[model samples]
Target chain A: MRTIFYISDGTALTAEAFGRAMLSMFPLKVVHKTLAFIDTEAKATAAVNKINQAYADSGERPVIFHTFVSIDIKRIIMSSQGSCYDFLDYFVTPLSKELGIPAQPKTHRTHGIQEDTGVRENYDFRIDAVNYSLANDDGSNVANYDEADIILLGVSRTGKTPTSLYLALHYGIKAANYPLTEDDNMENLQLPKVLKPHRHKIFGLTLDPQRLHEIRSKRREGSTYASLPQCRFELQEVEKMYRREAIPFLDSTRFSVEEIAAKILAETNIERHRF
Target chain B: MRTIFYISDGTALTAEAFGRAMLSMFPLKVVHKTLAFIDTEAKATAAVNKINQAYADSGERPVIFHTFVSIDIKRIIMSSQGSCYDFLDYFVTPLSKELGIPAQPKTHRTHGIQEDTGVRENYDFRIDAVNYSLANDDGSNVANYDEADIILLGVSRTGKTPTSLYLALHYGIKAANYPLTEDDNMENLQLPKVLKPHRHKIFGLTLDPQRLHEIRSKRREGSTYASLPQCRFELQEVEKMYRREAIPFLDSTRFSVEEIAAKILAETNIERHRF
Candidate 1:
């Protein structure tokens, strides 16, 4: 039988999860569907009646599936002549039994923001906003090093790439990171040659040397880069370079994603246009 | 005090909630934040260490934040130095107050062939798999439609916009939606006019009459468009068209966002490609 899925007011995450689930949950046939989104319960109930009548007229008993935050409306659906009585009962039964299941822990609306938009806009905005801090390097997109938002300088295993993407995605902040390698990093001297002019834009990512050693070892065990002394030396030299250059740096040792983000914002004074 | 935030593991939803909270609840500014998606507690600890040391080196005590499935890790962060200690307090305090703050409900990871990726290099693969559906409309960009993993078609209030944006931002899916208005919708009384040539490419969304009436009332109260009687009439007419046309649709009345999405994927025979 064909099915109609209804989702009343809530974030779109549940819808996405369901979309992903539908793609792989069934045997590729006998599953024809429509996905409708309603912003309120009154609208959802109205939709159920129309679907029930349509199925009844067609001489078929279709499964009018639904999921939502409340059970008050299930009565509305159940009362419909052709609608199933146990709509919630049927859906939640097996769902509640699944292993590794995490109960939908209720949350305060204050902590949540019902953003109508998504991350792409924010990501694109930040990436574009920090145009002033960017600089040019060997065929790289660097210009005069004046357009960068926050430039990250760190030795290997210091977490740069993902951080760059995240800043772009979540904060709408453009972040460019330059790696400090063994040659210059070991001497504790050279920064990215092109980055020298824009040293003020640089922020050193300092970490405990031993921690760097562990991270490298896990990725490429037994390699020289993973050796404890190698990490220790790199970290020490990098710290010294940061100190000598007077580049403001942060220690990320005990911050949550939230705390670190807060600190960075506080220090840099970069204003976020939208939360 | 510029901070780098990291997510070691669990549902990024929790971390994401906290991120949003930080943006709103405090005076913190966000610089660069990264989520290295790890599934379990051990991997989370590993991520924390990498993040921790980076914070450790900054002369100023930086917060290294971590959110893991384990209560132990949560405890560790609560007792950790710097502002990182605040996370445990933030998460638990709300829980203690019985708030519905955790958007990622702890649900059992269930069965079904979920590893399937929806991307297809060939048209035949899409048709055979019945995974990717297309949407046709007036002067729509091929760049938008052709790249779409899923396309949604329904009347104005069928919830196409939010669903499309959600899929795009979260799953990196290219999604396009077409409005089935009174004119276009009626023109396709026997079948969706635009969808005729690409019938296999269409996915329909329809709501019950009462629900539509209520929804429409919110925008244009006490008008023909929002009247209960008009809603009943329109819903009846629409259902007749759906049945006469033999179109597939989801009731959209009782389904949660997750359940409806699941039905759609199942019906469409699409798969998810998640990293």
Candidate 2:
């Protein structure tokens, strides 16, 4: 197994998020072992020394990859002479292209502070502690279908709502979801007719009957919908539909909303550029 | 505007998260941004030169700050001696320490690609997924408490539910909230008396009366709670109570759940270390 470090200078949430996403691709393989941080300048050398040691201590030849913080530093590291210097030559070139970020060609005056603050609390986006009103504040679903990066379809409480919201907040992915209501389900082929044409983009969700029953119980207890027997039958039917239709489906019973969302993203091969 | 490349080699989410947090901190300034990534040798070099141009072209001196994925790259750049090599030195020394990580370091081989995988399809953690054996799985307040990292206290629909779930999925902060019914309101504090001691950790939610009215009106057209006048009066009373008890609050009329949450985290000085 190769050890990979997802380094970030900001809050590291971005690093963790993308890290988590990559791991999800190989769910049973990548484990984010530990998170190490450096928030200031004095610690830069120490952080460097440790990475260098990573190579020396390992008896095996491991890929020692590294990315730096600024234009000046990149140039400096690119020019530095040392045993680890060769490692930099080995990793920095190709890594930049896949990410779409351009390299710093020259070093001008840099606002160089050496410590790792991880993030700067600048409060740069809010004005008067209120967001500027959206062009359409009426919640009329003015968002166009064409503009949606991905669309989710599931029955109510299948964890779609939270999943859509997570993508929006984390990846800025504009996601839209449609619920398969009782009427729609009653009128269904294994797949929703409207989704037939968008088959590749469409994904399905299913839940263990008992789990669905428990979740629905919290929303509307004592209702027929929340009854265990009813849920059991509904789940069986949904699973059958998914199999018959050959739609990619996930059991939402065990996954956290994010996990379920990630699974769908993975299974459906939803190519989200920004999100 | 100065450019800021929130670069990441492995996970872009962490960089974006820190970017958002930094943006929130500095609402007025526009920092040129890029959450682009670098994972291979070529892409890494291109990204280095891109930052070079941003700083080189921007007439003024700009900070070339980098974080997580960039840590190692920072060293690479620092090692590359040049006109900017002196500046690179400042960042390298301190970074070395954090890279060393774990004062008492623990090393182990990776077991999976991700440390956690949402809950997993087997509902492995869903006690019910196994047998009814969990029925006797420890008669403790454990599940109830284990279900939330923070339990919000407020009246019905004061934005507790969304925020609670958001914290859970986003920060993995287990959050559950209990509403302050009329009974609790009369007691003058939103928090349940039993939970008062944990008050510092509890966040009190309140909304402008008119806004509250508009929200309630959607669900209960003619109910007293939906009346404009009643909403105004309730809001006044709630604000007064908050002041009397010195409970911090935010007006939810214009805030998205994410914004409300971000504000609360900031005001409460709760640093979600993930990002």
Candidate 3:
């Protein structure tokens, strides 16, 4: 099995994220390990030793993905016995040359609430959006419908709540979701009275009947709500409503929440309030 | 105002995330722009011209943060008229020397789900954790208490929901939250019967009474639950209880959900199932 080591001066999330995505494309069994907070030469050396040992054991050079701003630590780790993919080095050398200036190597500057006013304001906006999405979830507060940046309309278990939360937290988009119920009448495919005025902001989610059934079964087993027929009927009717209203929609059966959120943002042209 | 450009081969999320965190340390009015999907030399050259124009217009060196794995694209972007900090180049050159293998520069190997089983497994785990968190939020469903990776206990508006959701979506941790209701007497500081069995997995969240009051006031303006006196009483009692139980806790008033989740994972030694 191939071994992958993610090394970084900070939490190593960027290295791990990129490495995982890359390794996923390769057809091989992989063992992944992370060496985070490698901000010093000693720590980098220790990480290198561990990676080297893994390489020796496997009789093949282990893959090392790293993100280090500190040149000293970066150098030490780079000298290790592995096939190193340095995230920092591959671009910074050319950049420094062009800019006529060296970058200030700083650590732990990836994810946090910074002490800057603009960053603070952005964080607060995200918090507000997250709270707003939670409060307005599952059609909880229809009175605030006008304030929503985008409204997600779907049947239960169609991946509405998670998508709404993802958009709100990540992009600072005021996303509110409403679940279509049996009361709405599947055969009629009519928009709810409360959603008619806000139809322009609506996005729909649909999924395969079997997939929807499997998702709902985990939550409420053996119930009609979790049955394949119920899932099929709801998805079919909801999709019909989407077509009838000309509301943009996507199938959530094969997409993760990140992909679903990205698609929604792209399709809706919704303004993201935060970086 | 200063200008900041986040350039990347992929989504530019890493460049933006790190750049934002670093810039937060400086007190400046900055306009941030993201040039994503810069995998081609043409795209890189176009981006350089835009940066040069911005520099010409502002008469100031614009800051550019970038991550490009393709050497060709990286070279073009590095020729920009800006203060460019390349994330990839700062280490890869040395890494190539140590490994005795030149780096194979590729593009867009970050921030998306791949077709491989390992990547799909991680995505499935995150989605499951998110759904689990949502279903178990606010102590709503206690039947699956044993399945939680961590439990958060706090008063109303101490940010239990968002933190739980963040942990689930980002780290693939099955997090559940319980709100300390008025029914749980504060002065006595007794552990509730439901939580006693899961005390080892519990993490407490505390917030400044003023912040709690403000957060709640937005939800329920005139209710006693949102009153400053009520918030103060609950907070003081919760702290006392936390001290008695030796439950690790964090003050949510100061830190963002990301920070809070990171601390919880670190302090609790909770294994994150995803990168």
Candidate 4:
């Protein structure tokens, strides 16, 4: 298999994003390597050697997606035996002309901490949101629902926890998730009383019964909790409650956590703390 | 302030990443707005209206970084009164030529579920890792240390939890973190007995004493636990223990969680389950 390299003088996160987005356009299987924080000339030379080695070993030119602030290091990387793509360098000129300002390329500017600024403030908000989500996970702290930006309601194993964490980590939104379990009376499910006052903040997640069955079976096989009938019945009740309570929800069977979080943000009016 | 828009037919995550990386090159303040899941022509027209409205309201052309698989939608977005940048379109021809494959542009491919493939497996790994990290957090499940790809050790408020979660969420690496607290004999700290066998998987995180003090102060006001002297002493003991035990450590004072996670991945040999 061919190798794809994401190299940068900083975290190389932008390079990874660039490569991943580009590669998503082609249905191809390839090995991935990231050379991050390649700041010095020596390190850049070493990176070039690795790229050349990959090329020799695979008998194909490796695809390199790189972003570097230092011209000298970037020049060294461009000289490597690979098909290099620098999205930053390609767009910087046009963007500079459009903004009518010279681009001030700096290392770590993309994913670095800038103290006493919005970046630092955003960092604190994300960490706090993570802690809040953990503290309120699975209805552990219902009293704090008033403080939540959004509360996720769903049956167990319908992907509440991961979605909650993704919202908190990526957007710095305080998301608390509560699972609808057997104690909620699956025969006649209702929004828990503690959640009634904060109904406006509720967003629900539901999975297809078959998908739920497979997921639950992995955890508790040969049990009624993992039974298809149980999964279908619980989903029917919870979705009915969603409509009855007028809670906006998504079918998470076809979406990743990133997509689910993005959809929730787009569907709701929750203000994201970070861009 | 000028408004920067990240518009996409899918999650808009790639557009946001592209725009943010480009914008980070300039020292300017701008408002960010994302219009995600604009798949239909009507939604495309609505997004154009939003973009045009931002241009008119600000008296400055909105900078739109967008990626759309549909040609009609792309054209509609381009027709809006904004400066548009489509990184995917710009890089596609070259990348396709390099790979010798026709670009199969698909919506939601970048951050969507691909059933029964590496993508789906990756998603499962991430969710499982998140559950594992939460379960093993703060040394809560010491018995599960053998399953951890990496274990982060740090004092209180040194950015262990966020880093652990980021490692799990972004890389699908099972990360468990243990907090080295006053219970560990702060005056003469040593690697806890539980962590001795898993020493090879250990990574230490330390922060500048002042930063730690400020972080703790936010949570506990002026308590002794939040004092500068106390913070300094704990960090000192932890760092001493890390070096004494021959564990790799990082001072996470100047980095964001993303950067810290990237640095840890670079410094360690932990195999990531996802690219």
**DockQ per candidate, 2 decimals:** 0.04, 0.06, 0.25, 0.76
lDDT by residue (tens digit), candidate 2, B135-163? 11111132453333355656555666556
lDDT of 1 by residue, A1-275 (tens): 43433333343233333332222222222223333334356865776667676676655554333344445654555455443322223333332332123334232122132233333344335434322212221114656346566677787657553344345444656667677765563764666687788777677776677767766786799999999888878877777778887888776543323334445654576545434
DockQ ranking of the models:
4, 3, 2, 1
Q: Rank the candidates by lDDT, best first.
A: 4, 3, 1, 2
- Comparison by DockQ, 2 against 4, better one: 4
Error (Å) of candidate 2 at residue A51 is 28
> Model 3 has how many clashing residue pairs?
15
Pairs in clash, predicted candidate 4: none
Q: Which ten residues in a row have the lowest lDDT in candidate 1 chain B?
A: B105-114
**Model 4 C-alpha lDDT per residue in residues B1-275, reported as the tens digit of each score:** 89999999899999999998999888888999999999999999998899888888889888999998998889999999899999888889999999999998963378887875568888899989999999999889999999999999999889999899989988899999999988889888989999999999999999999999999999999999999999999998899999999999999998989999999999999898876
Tell me each candidate's i-RMS in Å: 15.3, 12.8, 4.9, 1.4
* lDDT (tens digit, per residue) of candidate 3 on B110-199: 556655556567877888998889889998987888999999999888989889999999989999999988788776778788988999
Q: RMSD in Å for candidate 1, one decimal?
A: 16.2
Q: In candidate 4, which residue ranges exceed 4 Å CA deviation?
A: none
What's the C-alpha lDDT at position B126 in model 1? 22
lDDT of 1 by residue, B1-275 (tens): 44546453433434444344233323333444544345555655555565566567654444434455445655544444434422333333333232223323232111111223222222113221221222222225434454456666666555554344333333334456666556644533455544555455556677777877766786698988688876666556666666666666677654433334545654665544321
Per-residue lDDT of B5 in model 2: 55
Counting only residues 3 or more apart in sequence or on different chains, how many pairs clash (N, Cα, C under 3 Å) in candidate 1? 70
C-alpha lDDT (0 to 100) for residue B25 of candidate 3: 34
